[model samples]
Target: MPVSKKLPQLFYGGDYNPEQWPEDVWLEDMRLMKQAGVNIVSVGIFSWAILQPNAENYDFGWLDRLMNLLADNGIMADLATATASPPAWLAQLHPESLPVDENGVRFSHGSRQHYCPNSKAFRHYGQGLVRRLAHRYKDHPALAMWHVNNEYGCHVSRCYCAECTVRFREWLQQRYGTVQELNARWGTNFWSQKYYAWDEIALPAKTPTFANPGQQLDYMRFMSDSLLDAYLGEYRILKQITPDVPVMTNFMGAFKPLDEFEWAKHMDVVTWDSYPEPTAGIPVAAAMQHDLMRSLRGGQPFILMEQVTSQVNWRQRNPLKRPGVMRLWSYQAIARGSDGVMFFQWRQSRAGAEKFHGAMVTHTGDENGRVYREVAQLGNELKRLQALVDTRIEAKVAILFDWHNWWALELDSKPSRDVLFLEQIGHYYKALFDAGIAVDFVQPHADLNKYRLVIAPALYLIGPGVSDNLEAYVQQGGTLLTTFFSGIVDENDRIHLGGYPAPLRKLLGLCVEEFDPMLPDQTNGLRVRGQGDLDGDYKCTLWADIIRLEGAEALASFTADFFAGSPAVTAHTFGQGKAYYVGTHAEDAFVAGMLRRILSDLGVQPPVMTPLGVEVSERRAEGRSYIFLLNHLDQPAEVQLPAAGFTDLISGRKLQGSVRLSANEVLILHKDTEHAV
Candidate 1:
């Protein structure tokens, strides 16, 4: 089933906290929302304290009236369970409900997510709240979808309290089944830390030096599973009552602590909050996040759950979005496989922690303000472009973005501190993005037959079945690209025995005996062979592998350092396909040049040729291809269209030749011969 079957059009509007406002103001809010074309609003996201004022007292009358008002105004509700935070009384009555910090200090109830995930009282109360809300709103006319506990693990991801320690032991017991297995898996014999019983295992906290690597890695896994357990507790209750409505919680894009891919499997719909800093000016990292979120559910379209309308309040010096930039970013999300565009709040707060956050209705409650006008215009545009809903973005290139690798690669002690996983992934993703090539992020074991090229950057941890998958893909005529520090360890962070990059050594046709890690100030050069974009010498940094070429030929060799004249880059012909290994972190120019050469050799082309600042993306649905061309520059730019004329769905303009797009403008194009405008 789709995320929201009842409301198929692009879900507009955002979080609406009517509980914070007076009854009269709520009526005005509804009127303004209707004027702004808002059809859905997420309510009661953090209203737990108000919903049940005291432990024994229940007060959902205000919410009941608010729901009725929303239904009467033709607005749907993405109803929240009000279990994101427990009432203050719960913490006051049971102190164990509060989370304890790494230093062993218990956190108070001032902030949200203050409760411990494994606390018995907190889970009992939170699940009870979900049960009550689900039963009451199971048949409500305004209910579109269920918004579970808000942003799980936004804070208090892991608690060092005694209760969590006990629960962590239980979790370990369930996983290992015996103490001997635990000892072997954790490699506890190295430090005389072998456990005699399950109770001996403790939370990794406040050690003199670094904790046991295996223990720490398992703790990370347990903590992620602990949060998932809390979510599942509420999910079970909601599904038992209202099985038809899809349940979702907003995910922070590229969040480090929790394993989002594992969480995505439990969620009925994948949604995330996007708050790119205005100073960055829509960096490639932000685009990568959109692609990552979309890839979480196997390339399904995700919802842009929360974005600020103008400025955010949390930053030190908040900067407003430049004119036309908000609209441009919204379309950017749509082009990247977002089915809905929403924001953090519907109305600006008069007084609260988020008073300065941008919203659709300002504190003055002016519906005709610039922010409201833009929101309304975008809402109208979504209505016009309803055909784009449920569409999928097809890509011939896939990039592997595994969180297990992310967690293990950044451990306390590794080969190099400067070896960052996302930075390496971004280097490759940015090159493809700048080349105007659309790409999809995939898990390590996902099917690779659909894409002609696959890029797995810094794949430090090779779990079970991943090696076989990559080998098969390469052997079956799929070009593969991997970088330094890949295939170095298993899921347990133990080194593969034979050599560096052990499992992939055969596929890559190279063996590394040692790693030449350089400091931040150090640099090396690579001498490229043959005549192309990669013909000249290029700068490399961070790491260089001491390579012994087995069967592959060197495309480039290090021109400096002790590993000079070694294979800095190698290519091997395996079966009908080729595998390339980059032995060092190179500059952006080198990465782009290498990508261009590979893509050219593979006969892969960009969707359209555009300028550097112009972004090109395509979505296909019902035998129609929708091409989005966005100009992200300060000045107007021109794009040459294909010979076959196309129609702009936004402006209903038919054009055959070159088209000029204004600064921060967007065009949704479809073949002119297919549809009449």
Candidate 2:
């Protein structure tokens, strides 16, 4: 089977913390769960304290009873390995499990993610506990998937411990092969900071700070890799006991702590916790995360591991998801190729830090609440149409999101503060979205031939073979877009000098002479070089790279500055394809307007071109394509879809090409079965 019932269609439920509440509550919780239509529960996430209360003693009585109850209740348990936050006893006994911050101070373990990733004691015990747990319930009828860890890198930027320092040296050796090469790449000779031996190096301290961004960036990579190793350690044990089961770790959305691309290599299926802010452009932000998760598996459907049933407790303000927001977001995930939709919690906790966090059954323990009603309705709808839940969405555009580049660029204090990486990438993504284009957010090393247009915004760190892969894409006539502050650094956060935009200068057809960072109010105008529909003056700022155009033509020029009339945007026609470089940040209009022309020049068209605040996506499987039309507006509006003959999957009504939708309404049209995957 291409899919598994272990992760059933439209996964209907979320986290269950039997460890927090008493055993008497389990039956009632299960009763409330069935009433609220929760079919799956993620158990054992934070049960380390209960499962193994002491070093010598292991208690499985509570968890075993909980799993048995779930089996009897017809509920599937998304069994977590119970290794996110180590028990207090272990941390107290083995002090090495506690993480040390960048300031070289040991942190107290009150919250989760405080364990040292490189600690041998933590790995041995953590994996041992998981092995025992998996073996105990490996063949349980209710066990679905093995969830490895909970939110792998919630505190992404920590860890300056002795173990990390030692491991960092080894990671450097493997990456650069020798100390001399490492020293040269890091420019250690500049400050007379060259290391004669590997053991001499220390973790970069933050308080009495040193301006060594390259070292800091490399250390971040080392830390993320270390955590990945920790996850794999437990994962290996689980697979050893139960080889047929799929394993996963929940990722934070667009989280920069660890390279998710690298982490995805070891996962059986990619899963994530999705909680976009209410103020955020819902579809755009959620789409980016969903595409990111999907891209990890190269367009394979991923699991929506955790979303809040009502609201979250962590943010400054926990607001209830508006009436249709939940359903719309759920379908949006499906529309973006998600095979499962689960929440952070099943039942509300009466006590704990997460008590206030929204749950299906509130503190009242009644199903009369508004949140419960919404959950029930959504669950019923999903149950009615389970066949559509495992569908897929494929696209013609791919944007490369490299955590390596993201870490290196942010740590490099040299770049302008205005060059915020995710924000810049969001600009291009928003442009493509506004133009109604379907995009696959991908890793740096994804198959280039799958996408007609591949955008790599601020690819600061040039990883192994990425340049060659990109060059091959351009050679094969695919449109490539890269920006300034890109191609300047290597994988180790070391500068690639000789010329600016190092490895990709030839491919981009522009040699960047110098770049000047600007403030928020700073302005640079772009004058039209050659006349087209976009011949008017446009605004650009934040940073301007004076371009030495080799084979590329200046499409737009800065109207004012020392380098006035210099190229702000350039395009190189290489072989049968082209590469465009945006030298500085431009307005959204400029980006959208420019990209439309470029995508048009390449014959790429949006499935259904519509106005802003509306999202159109198509999910296809089993010889049927379901076009999801969402109107994120207060007022009703009409959209002219591509086809006249189709039935709305939501309303079960036939629709013409010109169709109408109400405010916050979703119209899923079963259109063009021939093109379905």
Compared with the true structure, all predictions reach lDDT values of 0.88, 0.81
- Residue 261 of model 1 has an lDDT of 91
lDDT of 2 by residue, 261-365 (tens): 888889888888888876565468778888888888767788888887778899988788888787778877877777777887877888878889887777776
What local lDDT score does residue 396 receive in model 2, on the 0 to 100 scale? 87
TM-score of each model, in listed order: 0.98, 0.95
- What is the overall TM-score of model 2 with all chains considered together? 0.95
Clashing residue pairs in candidate 2 (N, C-alpha, C atoms within 3 angstroms): none
